[model samples]
Target chain A: MTVNATILSKPQVKNAGKLLAVLAAAALLFAAFLLANGADPLAIYSNMISSTLFTPYGIGEVLIKSTPLILIAVGTCISAKAGLVNVGGEGQFAIGALFSTAAGLSIGDSLPSFMGIVVMMLAGVFGGAIWSGVAGILKIRANMNETLTTLIMNYIAYQIVSYFVFNDLKDPDSFNWPQTAKIAHSLRLPRIAGKINLGILIALAAAVIVWLLVRKTKWGYSLRIVGGNANAALHAGINVEMVQIVAMLLSGALAGLAGAIEIAGVEERLRQTTGVNYGYLGFLAAWMAWNDPAVAVLTAAVIGFLSVSGNVLEISSGLPSSAISILMAIVLFAILWKGKGRKSE
Target chain B: MILESLLAGAVQSGTSVLLTVCGETVSERAGVINLGTEGCMAVGALFAYIVCAETGQPFLAIPVACIAGGLMGLLHAYFVISRKANQLATGLTLMFLGLGLTAFLGRNYVSVSTEGFTKLRIPFLADIPIIGDALFDQDPITYLSYLICAGMCLLLYKTRFGLILRATGEDENVVYAYGADPIRMRYLSVIMGGMLSALGGAQLSIAYTHTWIEGMTGSRGVIGVALVCIAAWNPAKAFIGAYIFGAAQALQMILQQQGLEISSFLLMMIPYVLVLIALFAASIKKNGKMPAELKKVFEAV
Candidate 1:
């Protein structure tokens, strides 16, 4: 290989050991947790893999789970590049679903399918931005902390949606379960047979949009400058506050879109079951990718795979769904912990 | 008598969570964010409940629970202090890890009824009207919370020890130039925080509920973090923050009990909404009231 190609490929080679180490440590954690919990670790793990990928149905499950993760992780990576921590992705996702579900049900076939989809997506983006922009403005105007504000916003978002879902949005047909009425397919994301659908296309288009914005745009350049050195960017005549605000708004919009797509394409309703909290799982994905959007695509997919398989482990071992959460935490901690080992030198 | 009972509920939530708030207060005073306090409390609650149930003794449960909480704090120290990971993220992961581990270990202890300790209502004080019912009638831990808050105040403001801890937090590099170890100081503070956090959990299981549930601490841990802002780092004022928040929660249940004209859920949302306000205020403060020592401890995001 040419020296440049080899160098370009070295990040992959360099990354593999870290990934392996994390995976191995994670495996060890699972083994210990399972052995203590009285489940056969190997059997559960192998079963998880088979159940997640062994069939055509399994592929759809993986894609279904992977979709939200991709969107949220991408948003996280984008914001992280600008040095803004949008831990509110989940809230933004929830708000998107919240705004659209109310609107989607009301407008379920009052318009053309394409027009309805467009409206839903716009509502999702608007909902997400409005949710996140509060934190952004707090950061810009009040010097408020975004992380905690967004976190508190998450609780508020939860309460808001719960109010609607439990009270107003309750599907009259579902016996009091806190979920919305399903929309007509005309409002649903178009399908691509076997449950795979056009949401993936939206995700891909988002990735491309983010990549182009970051690599080829002046705003991306300024964001990097600001992220690296806020004082320096301020000195360089960049409107730091405006950049931070706009960045957060876009960041929230994209995440909101993920919630909208996930609801319209996969879940079809806002259930209290947290068919939506993969945003917590997505935090690790963005971190593992070091907040680089392109790499987050892969990170999101990997997490998606682990969780999908984790479901299988749940079935065979009678373990809780939270077993996967524990595993994700282990992996995330290891990544940060191991990364720290490097910095310690 | 009915008012007396409701007052006890307010005191129970307030005083019990005070351990967590105090523990976090001590941590934040050192400029280390112990967002993991919730997870620590959960773990502490699990251990406290399990031990109390198994041993049928309250005193023994407290120690076991505190020790469990301290160990988790030590893990936090390992990452946040030793390795210098992002305090917010590290603290958050600590919460996630604590939640999972506590739930995993708490499998056998769920909904298992156990005898809990009795209240130590003060004599003449308990018989007095409104204020008396609110303050004087509570468990021994409730009184201890007052002592702990006062003790923390004394520790933070009175002695040379407090100065070192404060200086260690305010400008550790400066503290370091003066030949003190900021790391050692922060580690000590974190452990203190861990122990108190455990006691906080002990109060939850051994003092009030007397049983453990999965994720039972709910948002109390996060609220403890917010209480720091509410308390503005004053131990005594923290009690006000804690009691007021606890009362906010108690009011929700009380309004429901009285069949008041508000949505029960809306009442429940009150403290959380207040937390959002507290967070906004913390962010926008003219940057002075925030302990100067924290800047010395955690430099940037």
Candidate 2:
């Protein structure tokens, strides 16, 4: 007699179950870490929620931090959808900031405020696109690994900015601080609320645009095809290389836009350490969202909230801000682990 | 005289990279790739530094650092091998995890000094000529690196276990058919890679710089990763590649010493730029030799 013992469940349901389990595991792990560090997990978590969500200023800070993260995370989504990994977001962001700063410094006084802002944004986009395009072209033409190339490019970008800021762009009136001259007042982004600028709106709009493009456009269809199976896409007569390169350009442009927004909206002047962890944090956000652009927006907000809450934890519990990194790592490990397990089963 | 000094410096700087490359080469040979070398090195460096600082035992630090790194490797292996997660992403995540954990725990250890390894000149070899001083007169870790590199070469090329490891990387199914557990082999190699990377980190903190600093490994761990590819996954060639990068690093300092008027920032870009160029060169050949499993890492997305 033949026995049939297969269990029946919807794929989506199974996936949801797995995700919940992973998240619970991560929470437990984090609680253990908290206890080991001599802090009350319940109290610390409550403080994080109240400080980051209930307070008006805290909400504004969340929006401010989430702006760049949403932009970069969406950029990462685009690249991931094209079967490419663009770790160059860090470098691209730096280049974008550099170009925007340079443009603002050179021509901010000569143009109308709106025109100056547009010019700076355009310059920033072009700079980031060019920086990412280098790696994209190398990958397509030379078969070089984009992951390593993009990471190395980040260091190179930092050096370029450092060279200029230390020598040519030094703010003369700042008493030898390593920073560029402030952008003209007219060129700075207008604040919409307390510590909140129009960049958040731009980020939200970009997310919608990206979602629509990925869900509706023919280009998005081709990108998904390539990411799913390059060989099959090639057999289907899709120009795989072109799709990859264009996706990289678009991905890099978004990150560049984030850089521009951060500089114009927040810093107002280029500093050596601007947009420090946004690239990697955005990467984590995209990964958390499973490369879904729409989900990425929510994920970025959550990450940004946690980031700001890290400061609260630092002050209230005497925990270092870097502790948040361990939380992120645990979440990442759980997701990856669960995702792989479900796929194999 | 300048050339001799440059060569000597090249060897010194290359020691850490050499150790890391050898470690990565072994892991890749056994059908696993651990991109967490940087993270492992960072954590290892911190552990070694703290141990040395607290106990004043420089020798004990190396083993402690290895254990720390091995534990990290075991974690990575559990995810990549047992859980079957994507190796590249997991490696990157581990990198951030290491960076964050070390930064958090190492806050107090920064700027701390300890008893460190000193230069030991081989009596007969030290008097040979320009090459002698450059090669024979070095710290204990440097000599250990030389021994490790040679040992890896022999281990990879001359042993029955080595053949199985190579076969596992080339095709795990074949190894499984032969009744060898590919998963076990992968775990072993990856853990060893972590330990070796940690050893390199210990060398950096205890033998080279002698002081613990945050993110002190800088990008050398990443550089070591790239060197594996540039060397085509061969341990001997990895040794050569490390020294080549070392020479590039040494050249920059030499130029600065000669008052070349270049920005230090630009000089710092040399090794990274060379990595890009080397990657390009390595990729130029479509049929380039690499462990078959490693190639899948790039192509599999």
Candidate 3:
């Protein structure tokens, strides 16, 4: 086919076409992967849909999983908008859990149930903020690459948690398991339906607040300006460094809150596997939303559904849970490739 | 005697990271920052371990590992060079892809054993003092790494192609003006880097550890990338940085074995913490030595 014979289309139409094409390609690729592994693609796909969307308990699990993801994605959206890539969500989340657990263990018995939960969340926010602030300070003052530092910080965070669990936080009565004592029932988030809890509502509220913070405030405007062009923002008398630092802080606080919610809502105690892969999953969700707060919440829910389905696939078809990662990677690749096309245009 | 053994262990541990740093130096010199080095190593380790297990040929595993890693690099290059996608994002995505793919395919390989490369001693050199034993007596891959390091330095500083590669990193337009395709150079360098990184992973499994485990490379890939920066993109300096890091790792293991009061978890944090500190120090200095194109990748985000 001649290049000149190709039809030129409107930007919106072209974008829509690209999206559909990418989705089709990703679906086909995933099907091939499943087929290679001796599983029936059609059956797996239908099972995933039925189990995640059709069943009541499955739906509740989706909402439950989406809580931390939504919160973390909203946080990631803030940083992405500010042109800062925050990969330290895992570390921030872990620290938040650490602080929240400490706070819960101390005053949870004294306060009313709702108040205790609030106190734990607040503690989580503080913990996350401080953990992220380290990277922010390094970036702002030292001109260090936050991406690399944030990633390294994640390993450090894991070690810190491991240290605490193995020594300081290990439940005295527990039989050799490396976990902290379960939080008091008063500190736990109350379930609304099936296994779903108040954490989902909190995550939704966070999304709305972030949307407002980005759309309706002077600080948000300055952040956008800095993100768009640091030199231009500086010329316009904005404190670019301060904006970046604050954005990182806010981003980290959200991730921390995700960690807190996960503990209070599901696990009720900090364990080694607590917050496993949630940070990266949230990062993927934020990117899938193109860093839009409102869209991120929706994307988080979709990914959460898929993740739960991955579990079902493992049990039913013996497919590895890592299959979800392959799916996520394909989606990301397609979007990234499509984005490149848009930029050239 | 204790000091001599520690030094010997440090050299052994550093060999894998040293190879990766050498690879990263080449890629960065060609203006590509591959954050997916960790993922590449994971896939490489799995491939090498599996190949060694099945074929009982440790040497054959190296080429297989390189091919696996080279494919990953080609994917990264397609996005970063051909499509002009964001380098950092593409790297991160590739990392996830590598990890996911390896974990899925390597499920059956875990707990398997292999006939890994055994140590070889240089005749007179091995008989020398403490330093000789540490440096001259090593596995085949470790000896290969020393050659690779020296060869890399010579290739980068003393060759015409090396000049062109460096020019591509500093100014793609200059390379274009010189009638060379900068994009092609970038792709080649990135692929070469991937091959070297895969070799490092192969060494980790086939020469050092001798067993297959999922995610066995851990964050060594990342440490290698960081060491490239700490070395100021110099292959020779990367040698020192790699050894220092390896020494730290060896020290940690020694401390644990000695039953030091420090928590093992805290000890595990050493190399990562060092990377963070080194990165901060590097950043504090003005951006005098960083390739202009590489700076753009970090600044663009």
Candidate 4:
């Protein structure tokens, strides 16, 4: 048992050490940035760490913020595995929220909470799938670059949401505010702790399920084969286009599910600003984890901590909350620089 | 009257995208796509604003902005060429870095007023009818952009350097085998791309808006990237593509001014939607004009 433990622990330890080293380098670089800007890095770092991890409220906020990130990162992993880069998570999330909000408004208190939640989830999934489906089809049929197309679609989606919320779905009682009506209480996701709802659990379950699907399923094998080389997969009788399209749909569906949960589990209404930049932040998390679904969970949490502490940095150091973005980018750069030659693609 | 202004607006606003697309076209032609164009532009705008505010010289701000942008490109090149990082991911990181760093550093410059470029109207051309006014009467930078387009066209097609650059884009190994330093060529191209992108941002802040605002570049960098495809990786075609986008922006403004009852949000989406349609159209036609090595960066078709 001892001999077996050493074999398993060795690689895990080495990987952990590398991660720590990279993180230290990034932290040092970011500290210099802070110093250059006339802020004291040591005080800001301590304030951020203590306020974020040492307080229960802060921990809850971190978990809450990470719920959508975990969902989106796991979804990104699926598309990344299929050799598809789905940068449309922001658009997918918006469309998903739009769909689920419409459903929640109509089904309010008409069905049991359990049944209503399931329907919203499905609605979110369908919305997200359709959103990414266009980009996938364009890639397959039109030979359009998915990266640029999806990004373009993101702006269009935001406008679509704005058109709806500011007109058709505008809350009548809110004096022209661009937001949908709040859903019935029964439709909201039940909370497990202080303001921390079941969204985190759903996000976690989705991660585990995706990890299993990618590692253990036949479809996953085919997806990986296609990702490795489309021409080779085609020659080997794999339906490469169909596999990639499905992967794109699944990826978008997960992002949409995050939107649905944000509406049902947290926001309770759709707003124009709902889930803004969450997609890119989640994409960053996924990339940081090297597109591993399991690792995305931890990375999402780390990002969540940074985001929550952004407020603390602002309060303690007189720096803008956006300063945290610089640190996050530095961390990603360090990982990208140090993680060279690990994967050929 | 609206048509005249629309054409004139296209020339005015399109200059920024034109400069950026030209730069990106050259980079993509050299077998590297700098997604950090937006980041470079952001940094350029901020630095340009700072320089104009401090030194009171809009002209001096241009070179300062270019240097800042080139440094950003250098960082991207080091990661992509030396460390072999994923181009798209590194570019996005660079984007966030530029945006975040600018936002952090630009706190003081927000809403700060600065002296900017004065418009220059060509003497006789400005007196002509619609076409002359729309085409010839504008900022000095706008006139410079016309020259830039022509210069870039000549550099890409009429020069030996252009041949080597295009060859590098097609296949770096082939260029290497022919005894050319492909890596150095890529570095130069990417740096040039970054500098030009910053120049566009400088035009935007110093010549166009004449004030500092966070994220003022506003997806123009990404729009420039998208236009490269429609341009077929050619600098001349990029001018036409960029003006079309500019025309869309002008249309949005015109419609809004007319109080056309259409939601401004819908109109705001025109440029993006148009890009999507153009991309689809271009792809379906299968012009097959993309750089060979750049083709590997996108999904295999």
Q: What's the TM-score of every candidate structure?
A: 0.93, 0.94, 0.95, 0.96
Candidates 2 and 3 compared: the better one by DockQ is 2
Ranking by TM-score: 4, 3, 2, 1
lDDT of 3 at A132: 89
**Model 4 misplaced regions, further than 4 Å:** A1-15, B299-301
For model 3, the stretches where C-alpha displacement exceeds 4 angstroms are A1-10, A340-345
lDDT of 4 by residue, B71-189 (tens): 99899889888887778878888988988888878989986788788788788988888878877887777888889889999998999888899999999888889899989988998
The number of residue pairs in model 1 that clash at the backbone is 3
Tell me the deviation in Å of residue B206 in model 3: 0.8
Query: iRMS for model 4?
Result: 2.5
Best prediction by TM-score: 4
Encode model 3's per-residue lDDT on B1-301: one tens digit a residue: 7788788888898898999999989999999999888888888888988898899988888899999999989998998988777787788788888888888988888877777798999999998888898899999999999999999999999999999999999999999999999999999999988888888888888888887776788788878887888888989888877887788888888998888999999988888888888887787775338798997886554
Candidate 2 — which pairs collide? Answer: none
The CAPRI-style docking tier of model 3 reads medium
Displacement of residue B12 (Cα, Å) in model 4 is 1.5
Cα lDDT tens digits, model 1, A1-345, are: 698797568665676776688779878987898899899998887777777788887778888788888888888766676677777887888898888777788888999999998888888888989998988998778876676677767777777777778777889998877788887778889989788889887887787788788778999999877776788999999998888888889888887888788778887888755444666666667766667778778888888888788788778899887777687667767766765322210
Q: What does DockQ give for each predicted structure?
A: 0.51, 0.70, 0.65, 0.65
Question: Which residue pairs come into collision in candidate 1?
Answer: A144-B283, B169-B293, B170-B293
Question: Chain A of model 4, TM-score against the native?
Answer: 0.93
**Candidate lDDT values, in order:** 0.78, 0.87, 0.86, 0.88
Model 3 chain B poorest ten-residue lDDT run: B280-289
